[model samples]
Target: MTHTWALVNLKPGVGKSTTAVFAAQAAYEEGLKPLLVDADDGRSCLAAYNRADGFKWPVIGLAEPDLHRKLPDLDGGVDLVIIDVPQVEDHARIARGALRYADTWIVPVAPSHYEVDRMFEPPRGAADDSGRYRLLEFFEEVQDMRRSPADVVVSLNRTNRAKRTKTGPDAEVREALEDKGFEVLNTVIPWHDDRFRQAILPRTPGTNMRRLVRELLDRKGATQ
Candidate 1:
């Protein structure tokens, strides 16, 4: 069975594109055919695929608002489809399309108080907004539109594992998200300059990312 996942966030620069690329790489390494779709106008994933020398899976840029309708024609017999969705604050239509199309939604967030606060911030613009654009609230709307509830999980990225003790910021943030009703993935991606902060692909991933992909696959399997 093919799995479709959309990496989303309320704001940009939260490792959505990076997670999408690395997850696809890990899936390929695990002998799965993964199709990466760059639904953000930034096209970061598509650019990374183009710059890399030997990528196992194919990546295409589809930054259209009607992504849900268009992606079915491009499945190409792949085992997985990972979408790098644009931020909901600025690109609600594109984000919603991806949300509607995916069976799983992975939200990558850094371990910090500010990032946690921003997740509930109302989206920019809108004269008479009623907080529908907020990340969690927007997900509620998307859930109503879907035929079945998609598996929504949060991936803790850019973490300082050295400081992630019992009462660390990472732990606090994880607790907060869970309190608000979110399935926080057990895998926490640590901060590594060579692996995460640089251009994606064409390099070996660290153990954390490999574990994250394995956990994601396990979640998908359980739902199936």
Candidate 2:
């Protein structure tokens, strides 16, 4: 069975693409044949795959709004599928389509007041059926459609080391999210040097990403 995971967020630069790539890499290291689907029209994930010299997995760009339908066709014989979804604010249709088929929805959130504030607001002028609505509605509609709630978790990404103190942004964001009844993962991706941003080389999974992969697998195992 193919375990499909979607990395989604309402705002940009939240490390969605980076998380997708690193997660795929971690899955690969774990002896899983991971397929990366770049569902974002920006094609950032696909571009990263293109630039990498020795990336072993198959990465395809399916930026169309009908990704839910097309994704299954591409999943044959794969152990895992990691989807890099577009920002919900701009690509609601595509994001909605991806959510319909996703088994796990991973939300990457930066520890910032603005990003956290944007999480609760629906996209302006968005229809109720759009991805923006699904995001703001906290996947309630998608859950209703599937007859069960999706496995969703928030990953705190690009955290500053100094801000990890009790009263810093990381703690504040985690508290706020927990107060809102969201599950925030303990594994955090810290703000690294420029080398972390460059995806041209085959990346060895970082400690944070390895922990994230383990958490994801552990959750999937417990659910099973």
Candidate 3:
């Protein structure tokens, strides 16, 4: 089965390229022909894919974000294509374009109030004012990309394990997403310099990157 995924959001500084590069690399590692499509002009993921050497997969850089008109062929040899999109005021346009061809859309939210609020804003506005209660449920119903059952995952990235706050922004946002029956990834990518440094280079996913990818691709409840 072919799967196309887009890592998107209107939120910037939230590790969009990192998630896109590795997820495609992960698909390749699983013996699939993965294609890394860089939707942003930043070329960060393309730079990383070029520097992170020893990749057994093929990653293509698409400077344009409109896959609806740009993607030439997806079913021929591409088993999976991961896209890194721009985080802008209207990224919802590019994201919606990606969703036109995506099997899943992964919105990586950095563990912070600002990031969460920004990430949830677009989908939130679609919500009906149910007195601010059960608002997340309304968000999910409207956020589904495919009428055939869309899988929109809210993944927490750049998390701090050392920090402990029971009812913080991270917990609350995640709770809202999960309360609506969304499948949240269990492994949160830690905030590390190496990850940012590695983003400049390209090729294969690192150990930490691979672990997080496994968390996303693994069975719903099975232990990794």
Give all TM-scores, in the order shown. Answer: 0.91, 0.88, 0.71
Q: How high is the CA lDDT of each candidate model?
A: 0.85, 0.80, 0.63
Write the residue-wise lDDT of candidate 1 on 19-63 in tens digits. 888888888888889999999999888788877854888888899
Model 1 scores worst on lDDT over the 10 consecutive residues at 124-133
Q: State the lDDT of candidate 2 residue by residue for 1-224, as single tens digits.
A: 77889998877788899889888888888788999999887888888877775389888888888887899888999999999999887887888888888889998998887788767665467764454533647476566666456798999988875234577889899898887678988788887656468546545455677777888888888887
TM-score of 1: 0.91
Q: Distance from true position, residue 128, model 3, in Å?
A: 14
Candidate 3, residues 1-224, lDDT tens digits: the string is 55666786665677888777766666666667877777776787767766766366666666554675676465467776787867644454665566666656677877766665555453444453433422243334335644554456767777775242357766666676666455667666667766454454433456555666665555422422
Q: Name the regions of candidate 1 deviating beyond 4 angstroms.
A: 123-133, 162-165, 204-206
Q: After superposing candidate 3 on the true structure, give the runs of residues whose Cα lies further than 4 Å from its correct spot.
A: 51-55, 63-66, 69-72, 122-147, 162-173, 176-183, 199-208, 219-224
